[model samples]
Target chain A: MREMIKMVVVLTVLSSFSGGLLAAIRNNTKERIEYQQLKFVKGPAIRSILEGCSNDPIVDRFKIKDGDVEHSFFVGVFDGKPSTVALESFGKGFGGNIGVMVGVNVKEDTIVGVGVTTHSETPGVGSRAKTEPDFTAQFQGLPLKKEFKVKADGGQVDALSGATVTSRGVSAALTDAAGIYERVKPQLMEKLKTFAN
Target chain B: MAKTLTQEFVKGLWDEIPPFRLVLGLCPTLAVTKTVENGIGMGLATTFVLVFSNILVSALRKIIPSKVRIACFIIVIATFVTVVELLMQAFTYPLFLKLGIFIPLIVVNCIVLGRAEAFASKNSVLASTADGLGIGVGFTLALGALGGVREILGNGTFLGKTVFGPAFQPFTFMVEAPGAFVCLGLMLCLMNLVGKK
Candidate 1:
């Protein structure tokens, strides 16, 4: 019993120290990490989808609260108007969660572009969702009211060859984005007003 | 003591080199070697974890009870891996994205835990640090070679740069899963052949 207590105490102390050390490192690098993620992982897709924006989307980003969740909106001033915004929505993917960035031209009630922000899909197979522009290009100009689904499921978009599951994941993410946009349209519009000034 | 310390370092470079002589840490070895860039990133991230964990484990070896030492070692290792993950996300976001999933997966990597148990827990801190460095360099070299071969044959490029002429037909198979296994197998056979002498 005494030995058991000693073992537990030692383990606890060690774990606490480890936890504290990690927390320190995390806090120290938090800002730089957010910047890196924005610049590299999410930046390219956001830029490609929201091209021709006068302001940097990453810098002009804001978050809105809808109940417990906070949704990030990247404001794009295109043609000298902050009428476009991109937001992330997630859905089940072949390997894990797939994050899709849906760019909305709020005034037009249509998607400006769609890009895969993050995904764990198989490389060269399901990962075509990220690398292959042709797959994502189909999302452009899609009306907010349109139901997004792969052609195999009787929808318009053609799925990537040999990556049907990933295709479905992308479609599902876009569908989810449509719903999110509908729910947050009023707040999103209000936020866009701030970026314009 | 001095000779043994030197031995610990030298052994990891060849006699016990990972994914080749030891046949350990095969997950990242196979996954990240798709590109030399990814291989080097994964290798360095892993080395950072290995070195720090080994040092911490060795420093605390005398105080830790044998009964729950594994738990303690895991805690130490996990903290280091998280630190690596966070730092990489901050400083090297592109590489971080390229080696996605594999970064966090380093927590469960056998090499880190294996070193803590088989070496750091018993050895002096200096010796353990040397061991970590040697093993890390070896892992990096092996991964780099594998990635170089795959990239060259599969894409007719070296580190994403065009090496072969436009007319050169890529082998294609070299970048695929089967090719990773075959290449590693052939490399191991060659190492064995050389070792026999």
Candidate 2:
């Protein structure tokens, strides 16, 4: 009992110390992290995908309402032109959940960028969607209007070397995003004016 | 005091190496090590957490109760993980995205918990700190070697730079899961062959 009491006291002290250090680091770095998130993932995405892009507000699922559910999105704009738009595609990959954000230029129906925000592919196999030719290269110049798919399914894109399931998952997500873009393409273009403001 | 601290520090590298010697952190060791860049990134993140947690636990060794020690260790480890996650996001955004859940998963890395319970709990602060550094370095070496072999064969690249001639046909299997085991097994054989046990 005496030893147990001593052990409890030790653990409490450790917890407090670790908690204090953690709070200190988080407080110090929070601003830098916010700045980076704005500068890199969201900002570069806009410049690459949108024309005459300057600044854009990234809207998560909160503001945008869906039919019965709200979805997440971000847009880039300059003057009045909707230069860039990003749509999230949540889909199942070979191993599990996959989330990809595809940035598109509605004017030319071309993809300005692709980023895998989340993935649970089978490590080296399916996860290569972020790096390899068969996945990302396919997005570089394809029309947002074209049916997104793997070459195996008679589309113009090649699937990953051994990750057909994941390849298919990402393809489907892109397809869904493309279709959604087609529907809201005009509204998104008009709404680009509000991105920076 | 110095001799006692020496034992605490030396054990992490020699007697209980996290990956190759102890076989504790096999997940990321097997998963992200296709390139030296990813492997080094993961190892360093692990080290950062290990060092911080080990020190915190050692500093508070006098008060933690045995029954709840494991739970407390995990919370402390998790907090350090959050710290590493934040720092990586700030300085290495690309690498941070690449690491994904494994960053949070460091809380489960046997090395952290093992050290907290095994060494830090009984050891002095200085000794635990040494252990943290030694184990961290050894783990980094193990991961670096694994990445070296994988990238050389599978991608024909070294540390994200090409190290092979154009004529070389990169072997695909060398970058996959099975290849991780093969490389790791051979590495263990080598580590054992030369290690001063």
How do the residues A1-197 of candidate 1 rate in per-residue lDDT, one tens digit apiece?
98899898998888888788888998999988887778787898899988988999998888887778888889899888898999998978899999998898999889899889888889889898998888888878879764688899999879999988888888888888888788888888877787775
Q: State the local distance difference test value for candidate 2.
A: 0.77
Best by lDDT: 1
Question: What lDDT does the true structure give each of the candidates?
Answer: 0.89, 0.77
User: Residue by residue across B55-114, what tens digits does model 2's lDDT show?
Assistant: 988886776666777888888889989988999988888898888888899999888898
C-alpha lDDT of residue B1 in model 1: 50
lDDT of 2 by residue, A1-197 (tens): 78876767766766787789878998999878876775565554334444355554443211344456555566655465545567776667887767777877667778877766667777788879865644575687677774677888887667887888888888888887787777766666555555434
Best by DockQ: 1
